[model samples]
Target: MGDLTMYRYDSYDQAIVDARVEEFRDQTQRRLAGQLTEDQFKPLRLMNGLYLQLHAYMLRVAIPYGTLSAAQMRVLGGIARKYDKGYGHFTTRQNLQYNWIKLSDAPDILAELAKVEMHAIQTSGNCIRNISSDQYAGVDAAEVADPRPWAELLRQWSTFHPEFTYLPRKFKIAVIAADEDRSAMRLHDIGLKLVSRDGVIGAEVYAGGGMGRTPMVAPLIRDFVTEDEIVAYLEACLRVYNRYGRRDNKYKARIKILVHEIGVEEYRRQVEEEFAHMRQQGLNPPVEELARIRAFFAPPAYETGLSDKIDRADPAFALWVDRNVAAHKAAGYAIVNISLKPQGGIPGDASAEQMELVADLADRYSLGEIRVTHAQNLVLPHVRKADLPAVWQALEEAGLAEANLDLITDIIACPGLDYCALANARAIPVAQKIAARFADPQRQRDLGELKLKISGCINACGHHHAGHIGILGVDRKGVENYQLLLGGSGAQDASLGQITGPGFSEDGVVEAIEKVTDIYLEQRQDGERFLDTYRRIGMKPFKEAIYG
Candidate 1:
């Protein structure tokens, strides 16, 4: 990954972050000594994105919209090799998590991150966290306008805001410039889609969508809103949630619960009322400021008229191109998706060496930029089509050239009991076993576009709720048990996975997954994906294959 075109830290931004680092350093010292209790220091540590995991501390650093520079990626590799383990995990939230951080080393990590005009602020706690957008924010032809500037605007305004510091629960916001929903906007607390109406640009807002023990697709809250008015409108929504969202039960604290319990119309009425009272108290940034921000995201100086010739003479390279290369707005260019899911490899774990390799590749071919996809893969967003062979060779040498982007082998699983203290069962091994069972690349290709997600616990960190074949790991009397879910998707045709029958043992779960897929293989009509078949048949055959 590389620099975010033009957005860099200013003096004010740097000063604020630098001072916060010192403040946290002192707080850490006090907690280490005997001055502060764990209860008192828990929120303090979380406010800085440091979490106590199973065996060690985990530090989650925000990579805003999953965009990074080559220099920043290099620094990240250095941090991983120098501070924690020799690797880091890119999460579904578009952030990076080092799973083996030490309490004492956390400050130094923050210091190193500050040098890159980045910080861990608002990466945690019950505040507006990182605002993610389409990885192809500015470059997508389907986009009305680049969403990165607005994402940055939200990040700046929400960072350490005093008014909404202590909400009922944590909130997430996602903005998408592309016509299609790539960032899972409907699954966030607030989702904004930039739209054009008769040459005028506005936003279509969605609220109360989320995934956990319960998953709900976000419903449209606003048909259209002026760009300038979005900030005020969002504030009104947040204010309503901050005040009235349930706090009695931790599980029921999310805005999705609030929306479900009160109904969308009632919630909309409250937000509208709130907006009427305080719609313009320095809420929206001036139009000039937005224009200034947009200038930073102007197209990079890509070599124009690059030959669209690709060396498909190599069959391996051709398969990689078909699976990993995506359509680009510009002619002679393609978006390259670097699969981190190399066969049975972890979904998003990248070694320090691999990170360095990606940095070098981005520098050489992708205009010094990389984008992290929500599906736990990396993207060389602006690679020239003619350079595909060279880039493929480089990535192949680095073990990142897996041609299974949307295949069943691309399993998304959280680092369950292997790393997290909150997990009830192991996630990584189950993912590994299932991947190994379907190891044949040709077999995976046959099962086209099947999303298999796994979660170690009911928290749904692995996004299993959105998987076409979802697996949830639970504990029954000290034994790891797995539950199967059918027909979920995170795309434009969003739907939640439904539970099928009862549970299975660890090994049994893998076999059961195979049976379900086998049924799909047998019953699927021509050109139909597993999701399509499951939807058409209503999951009865798959349920019978697993339980009957």
Candidate 2:
């Protein structure tokens, strides 16, 4: 067993991140002192993951591949408490956003983050943003292999890559180990799935998938590309997109659009040609370098043959176990998902105390490691089944335990008009309203596995395009209007949701969602979920239920 924690920043890594921090520090002072104008400084701030939102500057910190150590998480909590409000929002991209950061204090924030070996570089730029992976990457019972090292490798390769720093639009990538794509693989600009071929495991590439004004599920671009060739292949794909991807229309600038316009076959042909060239140029790093990175992600010392039997003394504990705990590859260990969507609470909003508590919990229950899920939740990847009762008790006491993993109340929502300047409406309030509608624990259990996602704007940060029940906020004249969408999914069967008739007022949208759920409950066949029933009955029945 080696270190189970994520890869720490080496001196070279530290030098790179530290140099960036110092450079940005001077840039910040120059802007504050009016030595540089806002126009002159906008790109600089954005490159460091700083954005000027509605009321203040927002800092987006990258949690690479959604992995964090207890110390890192605690620092995040401290930053939230000291800098912004007492809470931070974990985003769909597995990053944390502090909405009230000041331009003057930004350098200090970055410096503190550097102490923990994390930075916000490429988090906001038109570059390959944070590479996300499955929260249960190493511990999943059916996991093929851990995807973090590969994601980290990509993070290194893509960070400050000169050719890609000025692409037409921002790029996102996700890597998943097994058949199950937990990171919403298909919705990214590029998705890499690890697959076994003739006893040789490699990546199955999916390109051109994105959700914005025009959402499309990415097509399979390559059946298999060996680990050695993956980096070169990705470079090839990005190069093709960089050369030909649309820059004239900002709306049509993503790689998905280029793939759509050029046809997947044509796009694949171009990528293969570029890949061949890149391979000859030695784009792939030597295998030894990757192996060194892999050592940091080696399996933790999992106590073997520790009893798999879960204690069933407490019914509440059992319920939590059933809902939040997932099976682990190690017999004695289990993967624990910590829900940020406590009933009627702001989705993915973790208060400083709660964050501190969770960090303490990870130290005690897990091996000082935590993961941020794409669905805006935290996960404790390694836990003894026997320790669950105590863990649940601690979580319950700290208000961190919410036994509604895939229930109706587990909503994915954006910061919306409350914090985002781009948003036309308030998504948090709407999600709160809907979560309150079905706050009863029993009611939630009855409406099993309903994924409701809300986006405040067309950017789809909340991933409304992939929800079983999607709500997109758009401006109608001057007021907030929301359109409901049905049948979208973010899993391996990734599909975009369809808009259901006209838009609704904030209250009306909540009512419409309630009506949709009511219809699902009434019409669903035995053992059918919300999406399953919707698939069976199509959209007409659902449309009638709401429209009528």
Candidate 3:
């Protein structure tokens, strides 16, 4: 049980799970034979996180550690073209969905995903879905090391783990190695940060956090847990959540609600007891296995002593470096963020042609590697300084070279009411209008890095609660009303945004944002970010600037 073999399969061995395809097909046929009703078939679908939303069924496919090959992306593209409406949506939790999928075709779709070493297992269920990490984990300069292999290890252990599959609500886990948590760890059911204390690597664990009807930020349960005890401690926390978490009401079912009700101290005590029990049973994964997992994530062969030449040559590239690139463990290389929100284009919607272009760029410049970020962008993790201009040129031809990374125009928005049945108002159109309003490159650069996030509904799928300026769209009467929230962040110092004032109509929302930005520009201290300025001056000036 302490070995990697204890887990079902690794990435290379996942193709073997395709044998379950025939089993699922048989199950589907049985259900259609009047043998299984909605109740009987519900558990099976729950295993896959396939839920029947208001109008149609949605299929969520787990993307282990948020890493995908070009071949896998092509398979997803094919699924979108054939099974869906020629489009697929990537979620904030590092999963992808096909909204228009028919229930009858789900089995076949799962079979197809299995061929590509993917599945929907526990994606929508009470069990753990995909384990996510920073999209630029290994490559980011801010990282101590890549957290992907650890995430991959957790993914294998949690996939269909028998003990905690019947939890009251869904669970999510996020790991981050960045100095400023790019993975949005605070908003997850369990958040892990890699840390070294006294020359020993371990994790700082946070638990009982999530968003929905009742949003909550996770509390730190342990300052550090040794590498060998990670899995056992996680299991202990889940057990505590499973046994005591409220299930009578769906609103109170999340671990967050339970933590709130009992208090974090009591919850911590309970988890400690469970951890002690598991430790006594020798259920902790072995140290050798941890090392084995680490071996898979060894750093790529990089040329030594490469110069930071790109920073000197192009002022535009320097701006990109200052805003988009994070500190990497390796010298002469950087993690480059490819912003999907280019000017008036849709946020996170990559056309098939665009996807192909990215694949080509990945092969040519980035060692055939590309990662889809949780913020609805792409990452070229291992780019050298010298090759950046060539990569930029290729991206420009593909219409993927909008250099507004971390600027005001690089907004994170969901598909919103136009597509999502859960949405009250359209999110994409609002994001488009905002981007259009600030389309001037000089204006955006002057404003600096301001993170604006919007969600179509209260589910917070678009991560509005964590934005520097968060917008949550609501329906008031027949029209759409947008609420403005200020001073929130998703990085290491995570905080939920506070409401600034009353909601605004769709036509007035962009003006309100402009008003806020104008206030920041006028009053901000030198080198102060939008968040830092708001933190120092409070929201009164902003409120007055916008309302008065």
Candidate 4:
């Protein structure tokens, strides 16, 4: 893995993963031999991250806390080349999903993943899925502390936890250590924000946030739980959800619904009661465990006295730097965001060659460390500033250098009718058309920081509810129609976007977006973005402009 500092799998970890592979291998054999019906085999396959899509099986491989080793990334690329088509889709949960996987090949894929200490466990089922954190976790300058250690702690605790294996519905959690919410922390089932008080670190907890047919932003349940007690508190939270969360109705199964229905105060009261009991039972892992995990994520040996200067003489390089690069915690080093959304290209889909190239680039410039952003982009978290030109040049040559970070073209989209079985209409094509419409770099720069998201269905996989200007693809009398949503955010000030009047055709929706942007451009005051303008004006002007 080229000397990247991360959680190394010990014997026990290795054995658990290895055993899962063999167990699943047997299951697959039985499945192929007609020993088990599709119904019988479905849940087993789902637990291993194998999904039965409309056309074929899709395998989602988790990248814990969005961290990956170069070797692990290469294996992912190899799997894409060998098993599926020549590409793989990186998901919003910081996992890689291969769409064209064969059912028989699933076991082999798991075995390959096990070789590099990665797996797809709990990626699909009603369990705490892959725990996500900031893509810039350990490296961000604004972070109070790296959230990955806490996330890793959650990973160890939740992995195959007997109590939480089958909850009312699938649960998601995000841990962010920064003032800015890059990981959509409040939009998860549980959002943990790390904070420091008088030299002690703890978490500010939020519960019951999610997006689906009925989207709701999470509300804060507790102000702070110290590092040692946080896990137990989380356990209590889950226990409460498991005990009382609606199991009869799948639609009402999510913890968000429970929190919404029973009120946050009542949920907090129950969680506190359970937490008191769990604390007596000593549910939190030993302190040494956290120390051990933290050691694995220690800062890499950064060179001393390196220059922070980069030759941004190249306008293209400068634009990429302005848009895609962020300040690293370590001076003289920078974090580079590699955009996957090439203009008119499917968002988050990377070819095997691109994956391999990124792996090579990670080994070369980023100390063999790679991060998958929830926005479906990759991050080279620890690149030397002096080496940025070379990195950007290589990325430009590979078609990975798009200077559209947070731009209108930098869309967050799900595989709609094009791939997903549950989609109402096509999301990818709408994303493509919008990207093509706002192809101008200057225009995108002028519009500024517009997070446009799309979901084909009400499931909200694309997080349309969190988008600044969101689009929902729906089925209108057997035709693809899109609805526009405005003013939603997934940041620290999290809120749900509102639907803008009515829906439109695929082509008409593109025109509607253009009109909306035009209205924002026309009405925006000093120092206001598209989102700021909407939030300030309350959607009235934009609605009138689009509807009229």
Candidate 5:
């Protein structure tokens, strides 16, 4: 058993080995028996990232590599229906959480998850969470190649990694295959961008970036690390973070804080030293093992010679292409974004019926594959060029086709006060108002691509920090007031939005966004995006236009 080179499970292989399940089950029983109180049980629960938030107990399940079969999705649905309130929330890091689970059912839930080849191992600990990649990794036109296999390799290596299980704070890792980052790599603890130089694949690494009370974009550490050295290099980065990251104050404990306090250059040097030591110890996975992992993610059988023909006459398809569809590596197919926002519908909220519909669409038109995007949207990754019309029809029927992926109407919003007790104000109503204001299809098309994100609180659930136009709802004197921020993005060139003047009332925020948009339309250069124009003109012009 010790000699086995690869650790990935096959169909017949036991998931928990019976002993591990019994161990966790025993721990649960002990906690219930009063051998441990909430304080002692908290750490053990956090080892799984299970937390009793303001309103409910949340169970975060790790989805390694963000890849799941239809059967697995059904299992997740079952769990959600059984333990939670018939719905689960998909997080930015490619994981799902049931927010209303009972403490007594947690162990049984874990055991249920194990039955479907899944677990929450290392999801909440100081150790690494699930390693995420571009949701459209294999399907995107701009990708050098799919980065899923490499992500899988890291997932296997990092799971139950002994040295990292006791790090000072949580760690996140993201990999991007496309030239432009679809994974929001810059906003993660560690970012890896695949690059090809002289016919050899390597990774460009970034370290110590995160979003929280203090948001910091990751800084570049190494321009390139060869594929063979990835594990060794990652070990070095983890060592640096674990050793130097603060433990005294929870607020000052993330790797981002350490990176900022010590400077990127110093952090890089420390990581290099750690990497060298790991290399000396020969802990790196061999090339053959990497190849074996890669085999599981082999490209699906794609039809030859797919065409990118645009039907200029079809306004609906044109609108879809202009907003929802992204460039694909294949000639005939497109990476389609299935908007969860249907006018006033909840962002990223997919009902059980909707999930089944999506699964059916995946089977019919998209080669049986679906991806949950970081932007609170879903992706039909491999939809054939000719099948787009049918796919759109099905999506429309299911209320999943909004045709407003990146426009002002396609607002990314958190659950807010309506559902989440942590929220200070209502996010859904604000988002609905903004969408209604810019509901005109022609006006939205003319306005072009704009990213608007909203969060009910500073925890940044909606990724407000990454939006081109960010809206943060705050409570003052028991009243809701929203703060506006300009010039933020979640792509390769990510920058936190700058706050604009004073906050607005719930009724005033939509007008504020409109005023900002009007200013952009006036000052924007030919064919410039909202972020581009905001960057070129700065916030002064927008502030003057909105508040003047």
Candidate 6:
């Protein structure tokens, strides 16, 4: 695949990354040599996205804005095959986590990443983590504009920013240009929506939303901050949080808690004040810098006057096209969402061979660009409409074509007790059993648009709090228990899911989900989705169906 659409690292960019790899290499050597204790090396390892998981050290590699070139992806596949197991987990934050990483081999992985202009910096710890955006950033027709350029700008500004390095807690930012919130933008620490108002482009910013032990939907902090002022405004927002955010309690350290306790009105007042002061200093990047970044995301030189028609001859191909294909901004192109959630398989785990296959497919069908969706799926962002059949065929042969996009079987799940040290119960088995039960494609199509998410614990890594049918695994008096929640969403109409009565055993929870879906199937109005039906009819029916 060509590197025309991907951002290239300049000499300065290359130099800094190369330096960090060498620095981390030294740190890893010291830790291995017993010169540093576990406590001493913990923060150093975390800063580089190295985590001590349940079984091994996990290394998370950042995929900024979920965009990847074919070459970068092949390297990822290579890393999976060589360094760890022959697999890597694509995470909700648009990053890849390799679970079976070795501490001794950590620096080598970082060096491999640096070669492709990628790294794991700021993937973990109390720093601005990976900046996420809509997977269909530049291709979506409904978006106001491409948000990737702005995402890149923010990434540059926030990476190793002096003041933000030691914030009260970890901060996350998501940028979206569409009215439809595909990236769960509102659930981040800061959600920026690129908008065009009166022919002037700006951002509509939302602050302090997250899902965890306590989930809160972010409130709008500003109606509009012009593109030139967005960076300064965000800096001010962070400044307010950095100064007043809670440091006493780790539980209360997130900006969401700060925004909740101080009140949105007060937080806004402080932020506005700070923004006014910060504006004098001109913190936003130069206009030329933005233009430079934006050039990389320009639409590919598409072949014009091509037919916009797709022949859906085979029923299987037709079903896949209906579920997986989305309209692209270009006339003859389509966005192909590749589901990682195959029936009875782990949600985001992709084998090295599968990763290589996707890279190959991207090079052939797409314009050498692939996207990683927050729902734990991969996407071919710019396939021609005429090429749908061939694309589907290739995917089907490789066992990568699952016709479930947002269906009940298309679940979002975290690596639970199987790999994550903080997990209370296993998430993979529960997700697997549910997928196997609803494996029938036709049955899944019947129960349309159910966003089911699972979290091993309250960290909400799987975004369970935002699922239409959410399941949380808990430690109930030394026993693993699953609590069910209903009517949550991580969309434009965002809301937190409410818990039903008591918890259930592993198998009981699966049965409970089936019962709840049965009620939805029986009672849904014409054209209403599972979420819409739940919202309109309330939780009483679902509660009785499940609990009773």
**Structural similarity to truth (TM-score) of each candidate:** 0.98, 0.99, 0.92, 0.99, 0.92, 0.99
Model 2, position 88: C-alpha lDDT score: 94
Query: lDDT for each of the candidates?
Result: 0.88, 0.91, 0.80, 0.94, 0.81, 0.93
RMSD versus native structure for model 1 = 1.4
| lDDT order of candidates, top first | 4, 6, 2, 1, 5, 3
Model 1, 39-140: lDDT tens per residue?
Answer: 999999999999999899999999998888888888899999999889999988888999999898999999999998878888888899988888887778
Per-residue lDDT for 319-417 in model 4, tens only?
999999999988899999999999878999999999999999999999999999999999999999999999999999999999999999999999999
Instruction: Output the worst ten-in-a-row residue range by lDDT, candidate 5.
Output: 1-10
Candidate 5 residue lDDT tens string, 271-293: 99888888899988999987887
- TM-score (C-alpha, index-matched) for candidate 3: 0.92
Q: Which tens-of-lDDT digit does each residue in 1-548 have in candidate 3?
A: 01111123465556545655566677677887878898988777767657676557888887776776665677787888888877677777777777788878989899888876778876777778689888876776666666876787787678668887778988899988757887889889999998888987789999877766677889999999987899999999999999988889877888888888999999999999999999999997777876787776676677798987674466765566666665556688777777788777888766666666776766666666678788878887777877777877777777777878877788888778876778898898999999999998889989887889999999888888889999999999988999999998887878888888999988788999999999899889999999999999999999998789
Score candidate 5 by TM-score against the native. Answer: 0.92
Per-residue lDDT tens digits for candidate 2, residues 341-444, read: 98768999999898899889899989999999999999998889888888888899988789999887889999999989899889999999998888899999
Candidate 1 vs candidate 4: which has greater TM-score?
A: 4
By summed lDDT, which 10 consecutive residues of candidate 3 come out lowest? 1-10
lDDT of 6 at 17: 92
Q: Evaluated with lDDT, which candidate comes out highest? A: 4
